[model samples]
Target: MPNEMNKKQQEIKEKMQQQKYQSKVDNVTPTPPLLKNICWAFVVGGLICTLGQLFTDYFLGLDLPKKEASACATAVLVFLGAFFTGIGVYDDLGKRAGAGSIVPITGFANSIVAPAMEFKREGYVFGVGAKMFVIAGPVLVYGMVTAFIIGLIYWIRQ
Candidate 1:
């Protein structure tokens, strides 16, 4: 009975020490500015969208149909995203804009290019080409799967 009691006490003492340590760490950790981050995300995301719209408008003015214009705009945005990522500007933008830089099609381009660039030193076949899809592969897979399921459901309803 005495050993059991001592073990329980020791456990409680250890838990208390852990809590004290956690409290100290919490006190030392600086809190992030939530509102500021949100604002930056909103602004940056908006700008990217605006840029896409501008591209679409430019294509539209060239007598392209709306669908084609939109597609061209998306391609342009993706190219810009990959280009910026290659030049390292996207990383800096990502740091400052956070999810703002991640929620757009450009972000998707960055996700693919970034890993490929990182692994480029390993060679084109084993590194850049393979790792290019590492981050985006699952997203594409799930997206396609979800689309197929949803399409099936819609067809059934029809």
Candidate 2:
């Protein structure tokens, strides 16, 4: 009767049992303190925000309009994201900081640059650089498309 179970069902049950036993054995007598997580969250969040602020300042210093400065900040973040992505350092930072590395302009930069870099490695003329726009291209197109649609809707409403 017990061996009458289906193969898949038996596998699932075994996996579940293994997980239950592992959880018990893996349990440490002394768990790490909560203060570490809180401190990490603050430090990571603050560093990310600080970088954003720095970019804002840099853009303003260039005599750009406020809106323009904001755009510049985004661009800078995307660029940094792409660059760090190329260097492979951002991934580690992302792991350590969690949202800290990702919730910023730098993350955007990383997103755009990383793919392109990957393509470039395949072939300079045909690789990552050419494919680099794969990620940001859609974002740019979507932004423009949405803006146009919104403007059209507003105009029609007016």
Separate clash counts for every candidate = 0, 14
* 10-90 per-residue lDDT for model 1 (tens digits): 999999999999999999999888899999899999999999999999999999999999999999999999999999999
Q: What TM-score against the true fold does each predicted structure earn? A: 0.84, 0.55
Question: Which whole-number lDDT from 0 to 100 does residue 90 have in model 2?
Answer: 89
- Alpha-carbon runs more than 4 Å astray in model 2: 1-46, 58-64, 98-100
lDDT of each: 0.97, 0.76
* lDDT over C-alpha atoms for residue 59 of model 2: 88
Among the numbered candidates, top TM-score falls to: 1
Cα lDDT of candidate 2 equals 0.76
Across 1-158, the per-residue lDDT of candidate 2 in tens digits comes to: 55766877989999999999989877855775557755665697687778878988998999999999988877776777777787799878776666566556676676677776667668966786677777778877998999999999999999
